[model samples]
Target: MKTEHRIRVLMVAAENGALPAAKVGGMGDVLRDLAPELAKAQVQADQIMPAYGRFHRHPHASQLARLTVPFGGRHEIVTLYQLANPAHPESRLFLLDHPLFSNAGDGVIYHCNDPEPYASDASKFALFCAAVAVALCQRHLSRPEVLHLHDWHAALLTVLRAFDPRYQPLQALRCVYSIHNLAHQGTRPFRNSHSSFGRWFPELAASLTDAQTRRIEDPSYPQCLNPMRAAINLADKVHLVSPSYASEVLQPSDHRHGIWGGEGLEQDLNRRHQQGGLCGILNGLVYPDTPAPPQSFEALLNAMHTTLLGWQGHGTHLRNVDFIAHTRLQLWQQAKRPPPSMLLTTVARLTEQKVAILCHRLDNGDTVLETLLRRFKQRQPQGLYVCLGSGNHTIEAELQRVAAHHDNFLFLNGYQEQLSAQLYRQGQLFMMPSSFEPCGISQLMAMREGQPCLVHAVGGLRDTVVDNQTGYWFEGDSLEQQGLALLARFDELLEAFGSDDWQRVAANAKEQRFGWQSPCRLYRHSLYLE
Candidate 1:
């Protein structure tokens, strides 16, 4: 009897949830869930990421090999470690380590405050890509039929595979590139800077032809190299996180029309789409066989208060957001009244992509959020709206100012997983008003907990959420229009709250299933084996 062979695949990414403390966003969640699902499909998946100076400290991590990698005009030694993954033993996890991996700080997956945007991170990931290429050349890890690169951080591998003769062996492997967010393209100068591509790969830069340079150069910035563009152009297949987002990127971005398309890469993406090399697949979530018991409204408040107190201890004095949250939590506890008639919750990173519309200035000289608070107070005086997130100091300040003025709104300026899960379970409505979303996990998680969502009709939200059925969605022709539409939709939902229609939507939401089985089947037949 002959044994059947499983197709081998190697995934290079910046974040993986399989390893403790390795996740920062949705990409990590996808990696954690996707690997195990692929394993069940008889696809042997191996995941690799930079150790970020933290994973080697894992008790189960053991050094696999030491390789000398040529990078940045010098040869440097990199340590490769194999990490034990008891949760998904069928899939292997590896991490590469060097001092450069921790240039920003130990255990920091991303350095957002770099002197130049993406300067530190780009340099760090460039070295990581080169080291991975070297590991492949030395046969330190088994070769795979496919090289899967996630986001811009892992995109440099495609560059080295295409340009370097020593890495020519990688040219034979099919390459799949996943674009998680198109807005963040890791573009840096090609030459005349310490962190430029010429500085990192001097010999390769010198030997490149005009056509090769053009293929890798930033479309908008002629002197810069764009890893996102290079991978989109050179990879065997380009994948967006959701089907709606894949189609959205084919059209040019129009801010005036409130459409966030391809940022500036629509031309390249369109070219890929025309050539039949681009695809969009929705991400999957891991669902428990039996759902956990839902917590009471008061229990949710207690959890939020406890989490707030813990965060308060981190600083000598309370920040405005923290102070506001503490005061509101105390007030709610003292009232000893029934939970609010209408409860709303939101959990997201406070970036422009996520919160810009909420902060939009209206014709009345007030922000959209202020308007929403005023309307909610008038419609449901006993309602409470809780928002949990922390990012972008400017946005944080704006939210803090709104919280101070609005008695019904509570702004928690930090994230806690326990508190977030509670928010998902206790709220009557989940709000996600992203200007553009590739694919969102928060809405899925909220729906899974039997809470209907009020989301912007874009990207994954459009795919997973059915308007007025599973949840409610709104759209408009401009930002101000969209903001107004969001307010209108909120009013409509408020009018119908606790009615048969609302309960039906909630029931439909809970019944919605976005499991990994279907998506992994697509991964096997469409992405990997295709």
Candidate 2:
């Protein structure tokens, strides 16, 4: 009897949540969940990422191979290590380690280079891509039918496959590039710098044809190379995270109108779409058979208080945000009445994309958030608004200022997984007014917990949320209009809270299901098999 063969796929990404302490954001979550689901469909999935100077230290990790890779005009030795994935024992997770992988610092997966963005990170990923290419050429890891790359961090492998003669064998494999975020394109000088393409692969850079250069060059800055654009152009398929986002990127972005589209690569993305090389598939979440029990309002407050104490740590002086959060938690605990009728919660990274609208100032010289707090206080004096996140110092300062002035507002300046989970379960409404979202996991998590959300109607939010049903969504043509629309929607939700209509919405939210089974089937047919 003949046995069937399982299709093999190798995923290269910057972050993988399957391994311990390897995640930073949604990309990590996707990498972690997608592998096991694909396995259920009889596809063998293998994963690789930079060790970030930590994974190799795992007790079960074993060194697989050591290779000398050609990078930045010299040979740099990198070691490949394999660790057993306890979560999915059938899958393989490989980590490539080198001193440069820890350029920012040991165990740091990302870095912010102030004067020049993506400088240090670009070099690190460039070396990593080169090492991955060499590993495949030397058969350190089994070749797969599909080579899956995630985000701009792993995009340089596509460039190496296209330009470098030594890595020409990689060209035979089908490449699928997933764009988690297009805002960061990883553009850098093509020549005359330590981190330049010419420095990394001198012969290949010098021999590139004008047409080949055009394919990889940054649309806005011709002198620079954009790995995102290169991947989009060279990969067999270009994938957007959500259906709505895929359509949005075909048009040029207009920031003046609060529109975030293709950032400057609309033409390139359009060509790919025309060629049938583009796809949009919504991300999925794992739904456990036994869902965790919902916490009571008082339990939520206690969790927040305990998490705040942990964040406060052994410092002699508590940070301003921590102090404010501590006081707010204490005040709520001391209250003798029932929990507030309205509990608003948000969990996100405080980047411009996530919180810019909340920080937008109205004509009356008050931030949208401040105005909302003041109005919410007027309607429900006992109401509370809690936000948990940390990013962008400027935004953090602005949020802290709002917390200081509003007695009913609590801003937890650090993230704790347990507390966030509680916030999702206990809150009456979840808020996510991102300027643009590529398929948000937070909204899905909140909805899974039966908490209705108030989100901006763009990207995945537009796809997942239903107005006046599962959740409330608002949209506008300008930033000010968007802010005002959010305020208007909040007022409407407040008026409808606790009504029979609102309860139905909550019930519908809980009934909505977004699992990995269907998405994995799409991956098998559309992304991997096709």
Query: All models: lDDT?
Result: 0.90, 0.89
Q: What residue pairs clash in candidate 1, if any at all?
A: none
Model 2: worst 10 consecutive residues (lDDT sum): 111-120
130-187, model 1: which lDDT tens digit per residue? Answer: 9989998889989999999999999999999999999999998999999999988899
- Top candidate by lDDT: 1
**TM-scores for the candidates:** 0.97, 0.96
**Clash count per candidate:** 0, 0
lDDT of 2: 0.89
Per-residue alpha-carbon lDDT of candidate 2 for residues 3-90, written as tens digits (9 for 90 to 100): 5468899999999888766877788889999888988877788999999988888888899999899887789999999876655878
How does model 1 score by TM-score? 0.97
Instruction: Name model 2 segments beyond 4 Å from true.
Output: 1-5, 313-317, 334-338
Best by TM-score: 1
